[model samples]
Target: MSAARGGLVATLAAVLLVTGAGCGGPDEPGGGTITLPPLPSTERTTAAAPAAAVYRLSGNLCEKADQTPFADLYPREDAKRLVATEKLCMTRRTSAEKSVSLTIDADLLPTEAAAKLFVETGRRLAKRPFTDVDGAGADAYWDGDQDDVKLTSYHGNLVLEVRAAVNVKDGMPDDVVQRLVRVAEGTYAKLAP
Candidate 1:
């Protein structure tokens, strides 16, 4: 072949090779290399129960008191001088069994006076007919109505009553309730004089 014809043929072959590689068609080896975009760094927050979810009265008192400092009433000195009594029972529910707990505290009051106060409170509670009284001490609970749990604590002359209702379905578990009871008792003990 002539030199000019040979050079032209070589140039044509190189062009075809370059075009085929750049096209990246399915027939081409390695096809098209794809690199995915990076994932997002922002975190997603899920809904959770409030820290004081077990305290039913917390919500109502927060609304009713409107930011009052209720903790001030249960001081350490008062708790030390206070005496506690409690009662416990089971509820009358057939489908789901429940436990009740009731506790009352009185400071500087005579034993008779304290007993009178507890009796009166129990009578009133019976009229309202809430949960059964389980046991008593510095803290107590009525574990009926799975959603609502009643709690009570006393220091000196101050009586703190809490009705914590589990607004969410399936509420808190027994272990959680037991933990909360311990926490409540500790808090009450801290209020001692």
Candidate 2:
């Protein structure tokens, strides 16, 4: 072997001896045990769950709302109206094809538990057929029977209502109902954040 290779082999042999490695014979050194460094782990790691979002109750729900979702259905916003100290905001938008109205009513209770109680009580008293909707807000529902699409949700101390005016139609179409759901979600973002 080259001088360099020979030197390397000699160094390795010395290290093996120091580390209690055997000389490859029945008569071995130490306990004839060899301990190698641990190999890299092959276990897969999974991502943790996302943190839940806490939505704030806005005083003026209309101002913080994102109207982009329903802009196509209702192109123009009606004349400005007075907002009740951010407690209530009624945003009315109209287009040649349809007119839509979204009402956000908020009641700031002293405590979050009180707010929840009030919302739950109101829901119970509604009596009307309500279909629970997912992800509209903390709690959400829609009218089971209606000529036009209407969706409602409660977040914190605020209740959001998205209503579409289609009185002439015999019943609400699927597209209209889906549109209302989207509108409710978009409006909830504004009113509850």
TM-score of each: 0.32, 0.56
Tens digit of per-residue lDDT, candidate 1, span 98-145 = 222222222233343363476446534542333323323332434344
* Residue runs of model 1 more than 4 Å from their true location after superposition: 1-120, 127-143, 153-156
Superposed by TM-score, candidate 1 places the C-alpha of residue 36 at a distance from the truth, in angstroms, of 77
Steric clash pairs (candidate 2)? 59-86, 60-86
User: What are the C-alpha RMSDs, in order, of all predicted structures?
Assistant: 28.3, 22.3
Q: Pick the candidate with the highest TM-score.
A: 2
